[model samples]
Target chain A: MRIALGAVAAVAYAVLLLAPLAVIVYSVSPGAALEIPPSGASLRWYAGLADQPRLISGLFTSLLLGAIATGAALVTGVPAALALTRGSLPGREAFLAVLLSPLSLPGLVLGLGVLTSAAVLANATGIRTAGTLLPLVAAHLLITIPWVVRSVAASLESTDPALEDQARSLGAGPFATLFLVTLPSARAGIVAGAVSAFVISFGNFALSLLLASGRTVTLPVAIYETVDRYQDPTVAAVSTLTIAAAVGAAVLTDRISGPLKTRDSSARSGQPAGPAALEPNR
Target chain B: MDRSRRRVAGLLLLPALLVVAVVAAAPIGLLFRVALYPPGPVAPLTGGPELDSFAGLLGAPYPSVALRTLRLSLLTTVLVTLLGFPVALFLSRSRGLSRRIQTLLIVSPLLMSVVVRAYGWMLILGRQGFVGETLAALSLPRVGLLHTEAAVLLALTESFLPFMILALAASLDRIDPDLLAAARGLGASSARTFFAVVVPLTLPGFVAGASFVLVGSLSAYAIPALLGGSAARTFVMEIYELVTISFDWPTAAAASIVLLLFASALLGGAALLSRRRSARTFGT
Candidate 1:
């Protein structure tokens, strides 16, 4: 009975996940206009997507933005996370909360704030920032950095701080212990955080919508405009591709973050795979 | 030199602190400053910051938006928690393929961006969507789920459910099944065992899950914007419009501050709940 129930759940899960993709693919299928069912599917829309250079450009721009934002987040977020988790900073709890506070700010509101602040600065300095790529990237960082910090912080928090202290008691210097022992222990969390940052930045739409100009339009904003202008399945195709990338990142992160330990006994044994596994990195 | 070492720690954290201070805190502070002191019809800013925006928010439309956002988030949190708790419990008990399937169902949606999920729902709930077609097949009147409060509620529930599951699953993992078995041996039925043994044990996770969904729903933007229509206006939506469309900086800042305060309160409540659960568990 449990197995049967599990099967039902799995089927429902697959349908919920794959249904939208099926709709998009079917909508663009050849002979789809035939009354009851399409006789054949075609790759016409996939081919057509290539011809739209603007969309192709948007994909490139989005990739570039995701890269930049993830880099910025790692630079700022990882160190902050390490400090908060390890260092006995004053008011650490309050500091941690404030650092992670952006998580509770809606992306639209965050985007609005970024835009308004940029505009205020630009008007003050007679410089343009409203329709620039840098500002959009900056906005993405605002949202993505929190996930990076949170993930890394979790890993850092759970780790036995005594390990570093022990390493220091031996012959190792503080920096050496940090680089070798502390960082290695937090490696899994760092990787997970980085993956999240990448996906969060990549899939972001609100910031891009408000901030992107003709030159800086990312794929999500592109899809938004395309769908508004035309009810084409091509937009769906783009969305499918983006969603696929997101799922890929998520699954990879899950695998990297280590196996699910729904049971306490299972969690103890589900240690992260090391270099030898060559498994999907979180 | 030892003093310098301590300074090095501070120095190591300077860049991040600066970024947060400039980007996050400044905007929020600026938002409050602007909101309190709405710009004049001509100059945009005349005197010091005032409470006009706060006062304005207490009036009809803004208050209604705030209430609606709260109502939707509260409903979503409740629904997601109820469904999520059972699923998490099942996951904690299962193994192998069953566990994998459960994990996939729970985490797959988290993989999708809020925008894509919104788009998926748009396809599923739109006028010519699958739900409409299915209703037609049953000869039932098709209700439009899109561009309504229901759409917003459903989308928020879908997007936020995964977080609840994650939190609940984490907490459930901490509970010892032997305790449940022990309860069962004492003649407790399944329901009684669950309530008597499992629920109290996993209460921390339940609170964590509730808070995750609550805070998540409170801050969600794409779901509300994509699924809701004019009537389903949320506070976040108001803040966005004030900044982007109207360029009313003060009012936008005011709206943001209001949101910030409300979110802080909600999160604080969640934290307190988690702490209380842990304390209760330890006390027992």
Candidate 2:
């Protein structure tokens, strides 16, 4: 009964995730080529995407924005994580909340806030910040940094703070202690956080839409424009690419994080776990 | 080792804090400030009344838009939470590779662009989309799912389901297996054991997931704009058009203020509900 249940669940999930993409793939049915199930398939739409300069440029812009935002997030998030966890700073809990508050704040409100501020600056000083790549990067950084902070913070929680103290007592400076003792222990978390941040910035569309203009469109916004204007298989091709990246990153992260431990053992092991791994009884 | 290091750490956080202030807080503060002012484009910066925007927003189209937003958000919250509960429960019951697959399946949506996901549903639910064709095949009356409240609801549910599932799964995992066993050993059926044992303990997850989904959907623009069509509008869609297309910054800011207030109120309600659930669970 359990096996049957599991099998059913798996198939349901597979269909839920794959069926939509399959629909798009099937739409590309060419007149002369072999057809896919549920309908015919064609390569013409796939060929058409190659000529969409906006789509191509949008892809480049998205990649660049993700790279910049993720890079900024790592730099900022890593230090914040270190200070919050390792340091004996006063009001550590308060600082942590402030860092993580972005997780709770609605992105729509945040985007509007940023836009409003840019408008104010332009109004006051004749300085325009809207529809620029910089604003897009900044907006994404606002949303993406929290993931790294949480990931690094979780990793830091698992590590023995005593190790840092021991190194300090053994005559290492604060910087050396962090580099030698603390960082090594939380390397997995940091790497995982960076990867997560990269995927997040890459996948982000909301900020890109509000901040991007003609030359600055991201892939998601481009796809949005294309679909809104023309209901064709090109949208499907782009969606397929996105789904592939999202699914691939998720799977890769799971592989990197390794297997879930039994509840008691995982708690005993003191390893920082992701949201999915925290299931009761592991 | 003393104050200097502490100060250094404090100073190190300055850049990040600056980014937050300029990027996050400034915009929010501006939203509130402009919301209180009059609408209809600023007249150069010479000198004008500060509260005109607020008056404009309270008048006419703004109030109606705000009310419509509240109605749509309430519906989206209810639907997402209801659908997510069963899925989250189903996830908590899996193990080994099955659990991994479920987790991947659930979280993968978060990785895809929201716009792309919205677009995917557009193809599926639009007049000429898959759902329409499926209905046609069944020889059923043609059902127009797109450009309706139902369309918005479906897209919101899909976009927010991952959040609910993750939250519920997190909270459910906190349940002690022995408690379930004890319930069963007492001759309780699986269904009773699940309801009496599992649901009570995982209320936190439910609250967390529901709140996240609610806040997310409340401020949602992409799904509504894409699926809901021009006539089927939400507040966020209204705000976006007002600011960008209409170039009505003051009214946009005012609308955003209303959205901000609405979001905070819903979030507060979720918090209170969560606390009450926790207290009740512990009291027993």
Query: lDDT per prediction?
Result: 0.68, 0.70
Clashes of each: 5, 16
Model 1, residue A46: distance off in Å is 1.8
Best by DockQ: 2
**Each predicted complex: what DockQ?**
0.31, 0.39
Give a tens-digit lDDT track for model 1, residues B140-224: 8876688899988877776666666666666676767688788889899998987787777767767766765776677666677
Top-TM-score structure, candidate number: 2
Compose the digit string of candidate 2's lDDT tens values, residues A1-282: 456545645544653464357435544645322132256455676677788788878888888888898899988888887777766689987776676666666566677777667777888999887767877888888776777777777778767788888998999997898799888877767777777777777776666567778888888788877777775676676667767877787787776565423332343332224434321100
What are the per-residue Cα lDDT tens digits for candidate 2 across B1-284? 67877787787666666677778777788777766545665323223447776677667776776677667767777776666666666777766786777777876777777787777777677656667767777778767678887778777877776676677767776778788899999999998997888888877877777767767777777788888877678777777777667776777777777777776787679878987887786884
Query: Model 2's chain B TM-score?
Result: 0.86
After aligning candidate 2 to the native by TM-score, how far in Å is the CA of B104 from where it should be? 0.8
Which portions of model 1 miss their true places by more than 4 Å?
A: A1-28, A31-39, A88-90, A153-185, A259-282, B1-6, B39-43, B133-144, B185-187
